[model samples]
Target: MHRPTPRPLAIAIVAGLLQLPAQAALYAVDPGPYPPAPASGFPAWYQDSHGRTLDLCLTKAVSSRVAGAPGAPAYMCTLLPTPGVFDDTQPIVFPTNFPDEAFWFTADAAIVDAARGINLSFGTAIEAAFAAEEPKAGDQVSFARVRIRVDVPVAGTYTVTHPYGVEVFDVPAGGRRAINMTRDIGIAGAGDFSGALKGDVGPFLRSVNGPYTEGNERFIGDPNLDEPVTGSPFNTNFVRIEGPNGIDLRTTVFSVSGKLSEVNRPTPLIPQRSTYSRHTENGNLRAQQDVFVMAPPAPATVTLSSQTPALALGEANGTGSWYAQSVLNPALPLTLQVTADNSLAIATSTPTTTPMPLTDLVVISRAEYSLGSGQLTLVASSSDETSPPALTARTGNGTLIGNLSGNGAVKALTTGLSPIPPATVQVSSSNGGSDSEPVVLVP
Candidate 1:
């Protein structure tokens, strides 16, 4: 399983001794995927797999008020790490004492309020919830889902530590518990909610009705209420809380589905090296070539063949394709020819052709010259039907022996007169090529 790296918890502490303003004004309400409307900022709520709405707040001001409400409060939600900021950018370290037990908690509205206050009554509820939902033997408990409300007032942007999973903590015995709520929870993986807010309204209807639909017989009124809901999913994070006493901490894993624009961008095309080769007519010699290309644009083709019948040729292969050929005669020298066309369309401003020559040669005859003869005679045969490749002769130390004719005949040579070893003769043809052979010179 590929888990995303966890980021440092952006802990927003709620200190009892710290003083706050007597009153604070409401900034805005983020309704999230329900009651469709364009997101004014990062979402303050998200729906779990169970279809329950989890309200997220950046500060304790709103969350504490809701958590302390007399009746059923909105689901408390916390921010998770943003995929853009935390994913692949930071290391996630799990606590050494992290618990292994998993338990589910379903607190009544009153208990939920008490939990928000981190009180004894809330701990009692947690114990009960754990006992009631303990997993049976042979069953696996991956996470715990507790119904709690959390909110923060100082909101600009903050990451949710866990998106699809809940974080668990063991509440220690009474003391100034330095509980860093931020650092306590572990991060699940990434989740996307892009399609969560998109309503089932057809595209045609959306275009005709604008942001909302007119009241119809099938429905009471416009569900959208003329609110713009089309936008990208707010990539954020979430957190869950449990235990100070005997509460066993464990996570209840859930899967979040949808595409994230931050992670799903267009993939650009890349160019690969192209190749080709010559083969024999009897299918003995085989040369294989391959190339890689992306689609939507037409795939490119590579051409493989020798200029002359000295070497057999094979048909061109499609992009990422290969072919085989055999040499007609192994004893003679041959050149494999390769040409790539349109392979550079994706990697260059303008498409260009690429050609390469691969040589296979075996020496057949050596050239002989007399010292101070100023002349040399050489003869050789090759696989090239063109015959009589261009020739050059030189000493062991690279001193020019003299220029030679296409038939391996040279005149006006001078270096061979020295006590140097036999000069080296090299043969090449327009289509067929050969390896260099030693030339013997006599005084």
Candidate 2:
């Protein structure tokens, strides 16, 4: 189990207030297929079993470059202060940037090798494009997964703390135990796609034929009117992970998918003619998962706040589509306060008076210049991949050099510097993070 350095009085007070029970600690581990190439040296990183890179605190957009089978031009986005993933010091919020509907998974567990004893693996994937099917087709969907392998292991308790809540399992030591958890949110009947909001699936948003309003008033219409729901602790919207275990072939898996988007497809009854219909009719298209590792000493004290002006606690943009939760205990719900465009502050803790600046999230990971070609290659990453940071360069004397550009997280500046390189190269992002490194002449 891994633990971070403790805070003074605040932590002591929190422990006394929460009065949590005594339990063994667990930390997250990267079970990797590993990256074929480097992310240019970033922390909390790995190339997952599925060939997708899992770099903590950063957003990764997985989509298709061709007709289907999503791959290529992979996005290595910016880093953000994601509390639970790398640091569980804050509550996990959904639809991070209004309409983005970006849900994530983080873990607090250790990485163990199978040959030594336990074999573990983890990763995530999203659908390539929208398609219909009898057997196979693309529909908007995404998921996170973990695979554990061990033999004739110890007999003890296995606990998984995820975004949803904490679940406990008792193992007898020699038998096979398989854990499966699933959740699906979206339209009436779109069939088998794992996507919730309209923006995720298509250009259209959810709407009804006539005027209607529910007394709840949180949303204009029943957002989850006719959607399949599963999982404990939450009926909808959550992600986290936890583990510390023995052998006995223990395998855990979970998936989240939704078909909220209405698209053109052949009516189920009539196969030939194409008709506009919801995807729920297809059924069981995708899945989801996230992680959380519990360690000794003390838990990270976190505060829940809205990134934007939201309507209410557990609701965003006039709909009950977003929420926040307690990573430690599922029974104890986290609180939120909405004061006219203000953030969602936890009732138990003091709210943050200032928002986190972009400089804190965006960063220049590495930069270098080639003496032969006079080309400078810069690599950067951000937690907010949705809003990629634009990059620029400057010289020691404060003169503008030239802009850098490249696909994904890498940027390149080929023009402007010739005979002599700038004494000092200062690279910066629109998001505020910058790095100044000496332009070492390299052959």
Candidate 3:
């Protein structure tokens, strides 16, 4: 969901009260959920065993009101993800020489890898600690490490990365891991871009922390003004993870001025929220940006009511409902019923009234074929039972099989064709419901 930025007057009032010559500060009004600290201390998942670290360090802040006292400004600073790699082994400094009044704020971070069913938990202790740093950076300095941990129940190859750092680990069937790393909040700052207000008077500072590799961070300032900052449109500064079968998982934080907008992509596997505002506080605009890394919902489980070991080509067959269990929504059950004519229909309600046509569902279930005395019978089934199934048949390798009649039966027009492998009958319903079974043709 997109959230609109605050009003300009609100930003100006907040900025006025918090603005100071030495520095200015903004507080995270709402920090989302954080993973809980394990009772048994940090687990194996929490440890940085691979010693993976981030290469870039920077922060972004933007505003919506670009024509008044609270003009939108983009602020940034250069820092390191780990300690000792830079001068003196100390953490990167916030509010570094950026011409704008620098301040630090903290927001809740919720990181998830849905594909592996992994959701991070930062206990109340860490949540409180993260919330404690408000309006200013107190006791928190460069290289401050926050411990993050996750337990993989099913296990496989799991990768979790954010703008601040990245973690790629292979877990056993049932295992856990933990690691401690610096928070991105340490290296964030804000400034104004409207050009109407100079210095850090009405600057807003925010951070986009995720694992997006391309166009991860972007900042578009007012174009009318001359002497605009070179990096007016900020890009890059994120980590990208490649998973099994060309699955690309990119996570990053995104913010815009006018109205809150999400990170735009071709096919976004997961849905995330952005931290953005249009107005300013005491002339400064600041908000906590929550980054979400989501995986596509798991496929639904499908089961056939009865299995037919073998069937005659010309014989008419009957089958029960295709029971489907949804991974995301289990309470709502789904069933696919196939008529003798191969008409497929779906039922969401128990009584099964007002069954909509399969065309309305817009999903193709499966193509079935049977053999008989010098003849072939082809049938197709889908989730919609209202409309008749298509009369066309095609092979896995794109060869034309045969066309079905009005009753969903087809006879082989060609002779002397070799026996093909048994066909597996399968159908998929809405919301990830699917089922399949094998049946052989008998002489």
Winning candidate number (lDDT): 2
Tens digit of lDDT per residue, candidate 3, span 1-443?
A: 01111321111111011212221111111121211221011110110101111111224332232332332233322211222222312323432221111112111233467765444432100111111222222322121122234544454455544323344545445444322222222221121111111111111212322212223443222211211111000121223443444545443322211111221112111112211112234865432211121211112112211123211112111111122221121122232221121112111101111111111121223333345553334333433233233434444444554543444211122222346643543333232323344534556
What lDDT score belongs to each candidate, Candidate 1 first? 0.27, 0.29, 0.25
Better of 2 and 3 by TM-score: 3
RMSD in order of candidates: 25.2, 26.6, 25.7
Query: What RMSD does model 1 have?
Result: 25.2
User: Alpha carbon lDDT of residue 170, candidate 1?
Assistant: 31
Alpha-carbon runs more than 4 Å astray in model 3: 1-57, 60-80, 83-377, 381-390, 407-417, 422-443
**Tens digits of lDDT, candidate 1, 246-364:** 33222222211111111111112222332223344474554443333221122333344344432212323211223334433333332344433333422322232333334323243
Ranking according to lDDT, highest score first: 2, 1, 3
lDDT of 2: 0.29
Write one digit per residue (lDDT tens) for candidate 2, span 338-400.
222111211222222212221313345555677888876555554323334577878777788
TM-score computed on alpha carbons, candidate 2: 0.22
TM, every model:
0.21, 0.22, 0.23
On TM-score, the candidate that comes out on top is 3
